[model samples]
Target chain A: MRVLAFLDGTLADPDAAHIRVDDLGLLRGDGVFETILVADKNPRELRPHLDRLARSAAMLELPAPDLEGFERAARKVIDSWIGGRELALKLVYTRGIDGDPAGVPTAFAMGLEIDEKVQRARTEGVAAVLLERGFGPDVAERAPWLLLGAKTVSYAVNMAALREAGRRGAQDVIFTAADGSVLEGPTSTVVVAKGRTLYTPPSTIGILPGTTQYALFRGAEKAGWTIKVEPIPAAELTTADAVILASSVRLVTRVHTLDGVALPDSAALHRELVAAYESEY
Target chain B: MRVLAFLDGTLADPDAAHIRVDDLGLLRGDGVFETILVADKNPRELRPHLDRLARSAAMLELPAPDLEGFERAARKVIDSWIGGRELALKLVYTRGIDGDPAGVPTAFAMGLEIDEKVQRARTEGVAAVLLERGFGPDVAERAPWLLLGAKTVSYAVNMAALREAGRRGAQDVIFTAADGSVLEGPTSTVVVAKGRTLYTPPSTIGILPGTTQYALFRGAEKAGWTIKVEPIPAAELTTADAVILASSVRLVTRVHTLDGVALPDSAALHRELVAAYESEY
Candidate 1:
C-alpha cells in the first residue's frame, strides 16, 4: 500500500496526514471534490474536472476553489506518482476549519489506487439494483439548496443505497427519481445505448455532469455515434440495447443486470466507450 | 478558544489531531454523530445521544458503535473540561478508512465552546425561511436508504440550506416537504405551540427524533402541557401561537418570524419551555 498527499501529493506523509478535527469537510461534509484519472503519469481531462469543481463550490456558496493551485498540486502528484500504472487522483476543497477568523479554505490532492473490483467491472460488467433517490427533477429545479447538481461529499444516503443494493445481492446501484426517471449511479453517470445513439439524463435532471461521459460523447460524435441528453424513464432502461455506468476511475462499466433481470449485452459498445475515453484523453 | 480531545479529553493535541485523507467520514460523509450539551462539567442526557448514535449507525449498516467506550470517553472529556460553563460535546463515529483489511471504525469525542451567537438566539429568537427539503413523508417512508431519520455527518445539504437562509436575510431555515408539510430545521427540530399543546412533526415524517425536544416534552407533560407528534402543514405554522426550534446546543430558540412574516408572540409559553429544559436537567 503506497500513500502520499500534499500540495501536489508530494511531501505529506500518508500515515500522518490529517485535516483539522474542526474542519467543516470532516464535521459537516461541507466541501466539493473531483476524482481524475491519471494516465501516463499525467492528469487526464484536468480542465473539465477543475471547472466542475469550481461549479460545485459555487453551488455550495463556497469561495471559488483555487483551481490554479489545485492544478499545480494535481500535476505534482502525477509527476511523482509511485502507486500504479493508472492513478485515481482526488482533489478535495473544503470550507476550512470551524470559527477561523481567516476563513481559509482547506484544499489538498491525494492519489488512490483504483480498486481491483472497480476496475474489473469495466470489463466483467456489474449487477445493479435500482433505488429511489427521493426527488424528481422538478423538485431539484425549485430547490437549489439541495445541491443536487454539485458533487458534494454528503453521500451517506448514496452509500446506504449502495449497501441496500448489496443486500439484494447486487454489486452497484442506479438511482431513480420519484417521477420514475432514471437518474444516475451512486458514483457514476448512467448511459443507455440503443442503435447508434447514446442517451443520458440531462444536467437539468440534477445529475452531475460527468466528465468522463462528456469526453466519451465528444469522442463518439466524431466516431459517428449520436448522443442525446434527455429524460430516460425507468422502463426505458429495461429495453435499452445497453446500460452503462461511467465515472472518472471506472471508465466504462456495463450494467449486466438490474433487479436480478439480465440486461441486453453490448460488449462491443462498451469497448468503444472505453476506447473513446482513452482516445479523447 | 480552548480545545481538548482524547479518550477522556485529556491527551490529544487539538492543533495536531486529524483523520486520514481517505477517511470514509471525510470521503463519503459515511458516519453518525451527536451533539450533546455539557453543563456543570457533565454530559447531559448522555444515554439518549448514545442510543441515537447506535440507531443511526444501524441505519447506515455500519458496525454498532461501542456505546460503553463512548460513554467512558464522554465522561473523560467532561471530567477535564476547560471551556466555558457550558460545552457542546460532539461524538462522531465513522466507518473507518477506505480499504482497511480490519475495517476499523473511527470514533471520537470533541468538546467545543458554545458559540456566543448561538447562545444569544436562545433568548433573542431567530427568523427563518422555509426551504424545500425536496421530498415528502411518503417518499421517506418508502426509502429507508434515504437515511432521512438518521443524523449522519452528511450535512452538506443542511449547511447549504443555512447559507440559503442567510442569503434570504434570515438567520435560520425550516425545511418543508414536497407535500407542504413542515419537516425540520437544518440542525434542529420544529416545535409549534397552540394553546396548551405543543405539536411537532411525527417521527413518521422521517425527522431526527430530537433529544432536547423529548426532554422538553417530558418536562412539559409534568408541567400540565400537552404534546402531540403530528404532521404540520406549511400553512399551520402561520396560525401557530408560537414557533420554536430545539436542539442539543441551542435549546428553546423561538422562531419569531417565518419568511419575514411575524408569528404570533407567545413569550409566556417560550419561557415555560425554557424552564422545562432547565428543570429537567
Candidate 2:
C-alpha cells in the first residue's frame, strides 16, 4: 500500500500530495509514459528506455523531458529504495499543468504503482482471453487521428480490456480487431512461435512499439530463429508452437492458454528473450 | 482563467483542489466527461448532456453520478460565475480515485476554461485540413478497441490531432484513415452537405459520438434534410457542398477548406447546424 510518485525530479508521497484537477494526465489522459523494470538496483535498457520515452512524447506531441536529468532522477529513486528487491518502475509524463482547457496539455511526469500480482504472474505465466477488439476493426488499418504506436497515458480502454479478460477467468487480454487480426496484449507485446519462425504484429497495426519485444526479437534472431513482423489473426494463436507476452519487468511469460484451449510450452522462447534483455541491459 | 471542478455534488476551484494520482482518470483515462456552452446564464442541452455523460460513464464501467444532484451543482457553479456573457463549462467524472495504487476510481467531475476564439469562429467559420485518420485508425479498425464512441477522458491524441491541424495552418483537422475513410474532426463531429442529403462518418468507425452532432442530425431530419451516417473519404470532402465542425459550443462552424482546397457557401451549413443544435438541445 506504500506508493510513491516521482514528480519531475522530486519524489512525493502519492497518497498525501494533491494533483490539480486540470492536470492533463487527469483531464484528457493527454500524455505519454514508460514503465521500466527495476531489477537488482538497476533500470534495464537505460538508453533505449529513454529513447522510447522520447518517441512516445514526440508521437503524442508533448514536450520532451530532460532525459539526462530524468535518468539521474530515476536512478536516484531506485538507489534510495530501501528494499533492493525487484520492482516495477513507471514514469508518466503528461501534457503540463494548464493551457487552453480543451487544448493539448503542456507536460508533467510522475511515477505510478505496479500491481504485485503482475510481478507474480511474470514469474509464473498465466492464461489470457481473446477480447473482441473493443475499438472496432480498421483501428490499425491506418494512422489514427493520433497514432496508436505511442505509449500515451490515455490508456483507459487498455485497462478495461484486461478487466474484461479477468472476468472470464483469464489473467490478461489479447485484442483482436473485428476482422480477427491479433494486435497485442492489453499491457504487453505478443510473440508466437510458428515452426522456426517467430511472428508478431507489426507496430503499424496500432500496437505500442514494444521495447521488450524488440529486444526479444533481436535475441531470437541471434539464436538463428526466423522472425517475421506480420499481422497474425486470433484463430492462429492456438496453432503456434508457443505464445508469450513480453514486457519490461516480466521479460517474457508464457501464455498457458488463450481462452479455454491449453497452450504448448514456451519456456525456450521466454528464456531466450529474458537472457537477451538481461545481457543487454 | 478561473475554473471550477464539479466533484460528486460540489464545486471546487480546479487549481485550488488536490486530486490523487491513482484516480482512474489519470492512470487509465477510464472515465467520461462533457463540456457544455453556458450562454446567457443557462447551460445548453443540460438534460441530454447528463444522459450522454451517463452513457459515456457506463461505457467505461464507472459509477454514475447523481443526475439531479449534478445538475444542482452545475447550476450553482454557473450562478456564481460571471452570469450571462459566454462561458464554457466542462463536466468531467472519473471513477472516484481507486486501483492498486488506491483501488478503482469511482467517479469525479471538474470544469475548465473556454476559448474565446471558438465562439467567434461560429460566425466567422474556420479553415480545416484533412489529416490521416485521428489516432488508432488501425487499432480501431483491426483490433476493435473502444469504438471512439465514448467520451472517455483518454483524449490525449484527440487534442494532439487538433494541434497538428493548427500546425498545418488549419483551424481544425478532419481525420481520414490510411484506407481513405474520412472520420470525424478533432473536437467536433464532421458533417458534410452533399446535394440535398447530409453525410457523416458513422460513430462505429471509432469517432467520438458527438453530442452536438447528434442534436444537429436530429434537427436536420426535422428540417426535411436527409442525414446519412456512413464512411466518407478525403476525395468526397473536396466535393461536398459544405463541411462543418459540429460541437456543443460551436454548434456548427463551416470549414472553408480542406488541405487548402476551397469549399463554397460555408455559413449556410453553419447556420443550419446551429439552428438544429439550438432547437434540439
Candidate 3:
C-alpha cells in the first residue's frame, strides 16, 4: 500500500498526514469523504465521486475542496501503486483544527489494494441480516441537520451495524427504515430484480446515492432493463427474482440469503449486472 | 494548549500523537470520548466521566479502555498546564487503524484553555432553537446499533444542529423527537423548572444521560428541590419557570429565548443551581 496526501501544495507521504488532534473532523466527525476504484491506473467514475464529495462538503457547510488539487494528488498516488491490480483510492476533506471557525480544510488522498473481504463477498454471494435503521422515511425531509443524504465520515452507526451482523454470523446487513422499508447496505446500495425490471430504494429516503449503482443502472437501462427507484419493503426483497449490494470497490455482489431465508438465485442476472457495471466504468 | 497521548505505555507530545489515517476512529468515527473541566488544577467529576467513557466504549463494542492508564495521562497533562485557570481536558479512545480488527486502541489526553464562546455561554445564558432529532424515544431500546445513549465521537449531526442554530442566530439547540417530545441539547442535557420541581428528560429516551445534570440534581435534591424525569414537549418549555442547558464544561446556561420566544427570567434559580454545581464539584 502506498499513501500520498495533498499537504500545502503537493503530494506527501501519508505517514506525514498527521492532522491536529483538535481537527473538527476527528473531534466531531465534521467532514466528508469519497472512495474511488482504480483499475489499470485509472480512477473509475472520478467525476461522479468528486461531485458527491462536493455535495457532501456543502451539506456539512465545510469549505469546498480544491478538486483540481485533489485530482493531481489522486493521480500521483495511483501512478505510484503497483500496476495491474485493483486499488482503492480515497479522498477526504475535514473542517480542520477546532476553535478556528472558518479554518482551512484538511484534504488528503491515499491508495490501497481492495480488501480481500470485499473481493470474497463479490465472488461468493453474502448472507445479509436485516437491521432497523431507526428512522422513518419522512425524517430526512423534516430534519436536514441529520445529514442523512450526505456521506459524512460520522459512520459509527454503520460500523456498529456491520459488527452486529458479524456477531450474528452474517456477512453483511441491509438497513430498513422503522416502517420496514428497505434502506441500504451498511456501505453499499441495495438493488433488487423482478422479471426484467431492476429496482433500488429511492435515495430520497436518506440513503446515499451510490455512484456505482447509478452507473450500473445507466447500463441496465441501455440494455432494455426497466429501472425503478422506489420504496422496497422488506417483504418485497424475499420475493424479488434476484438481490444484490453494489458499491464502487465491490462492484455488484449477489445476496444469497437475507435474514436466514435463502433468496432466489439469479446467477445469470448477477453476471449480466456485473458485466454492465464493469462495462460502464 | 498542550496535548499528550498514551501510546503503548508512555505519554508523548500530541504532535507525535498521530495515528494511521486509516484508523477506524478517523475513518469511520468508531470511538468514544469525554471532556472534563479542570478547574484550579483539579479535574472535576473524573469518576463519572470515566464511567461514561467505559459505558460508551461498551456500547460501540470497542475493547474496554484502561481507566488507570487514562487517569494517569489526564493527571500528567493537567500537571503540565499552568494552574489557577480553567482548562478543558479531553480524553479520547478510538478503534485502531483499519484492517487491524484486534489492534490496540488509540488513547489521548489534551489540555486547552476553555473556549471563549463556551465561557460566555456559561455566564450570559444563550438563545436556543428547537430542532427535530429525527428519531422516536424508543429507537435506542429497539435498535441498539444507533448507539444513542453512548457519547461516541460520531457527532456530525450534533455539530450540524449547532451550525443550523448558528445560521438562525441562535447559540444552541434543543432536539425534539419525531413525536414532539423534547430530547436534549446538542451538547448539554435539557433541564426545565416548574415551581419547585426540576425536570429533565428521561435517559430511556436514548439521550446521553448528562453527568453534570445528574450531579446538579443530586445537589438540588439536597437543597429541597423536587427532581423529576419525564417527557417534555416543546410547547411546555415556554411555560416552565426557568429553562437551562447544563453540561460538564458549560456548567449551567439559562435559555434566554427558544425559537425566538423569550423565556421568563430565573436569576435566583440559576444562581442557586450554579452555586450547587460548583459546591458539588
Per-prediction CA RMSD (Å): 1.5, 3.9, 1.7
- Encode model 2's per-residue lDDT on A1-281: one tens digit a residue: 33353535566675663667777787788777777877777777767778988888887766666687667667656766665366666666677676744544433233334567777776678899887653333554444555577887788878777767777888888877656788888789988888778888888767887888888888778877888989898888897888888888777877887896788777675666567556555
Off by over 4 Å in 3: A7-11, A15-17, B7-17
Each model's TM-score?
0.97, 0.86, 0.97
Winner on DockQ between 2 and 3 is 3
- Report the lDDT tens digits of candidate 3 across residue range A105-217: 87888887787898898888899999998889989877889999899889999999998898888989999998989999989999999999999988899889999889989
Clashing pairs in 1: none
- CAPRI-style docking class of model 1 based on DockQ: high
Docking class of 3: medium
CA shift of B60, model 3, Å: 0.9
Candidate 3, clashing residue pairs? none
Relative to the unseen true structure, what is the C-alpha lDDT of residue B38 in candidate 2, on a scale of 0 to 100?
Answer: 77
Docking class of 2: acceptable
Q: In model 3, what is chain B's TM-score? A: 0.96
Q: All candidates' lDDT scores?
A: 0.86, 0.72, 0.86
Q: What lDDT does candidate 3 reach at residue B255?
A: 93
Candidate 1 at B70: error in angstroms? 1.5
For model 3, residues B1-281, the per-residue Cα lDDT tens digits are: 66565633355655553666776777788899999989988898899999999999999998999999889889888877864488888998988777775788878888877878988888789999999988888888888988999998899999999999999999999999888899999899999989989999998898999988998898888888999999998889998988989888898889988998888987777988888777786
lDDT tens digits by residue: candidate 2, B90-143: 777877565544444443343445667876778888888877753344455443
Candidate 2 segments exceeding 4 Å error: A1-8, A100-116, A131-145, A176-182, A194-201, A217-236, A267-281, B96-109, B134-145, B177-182, B194-206, B217-236, B272-281
**TM-score of candidate 3 relative to the true fold:** 0.97
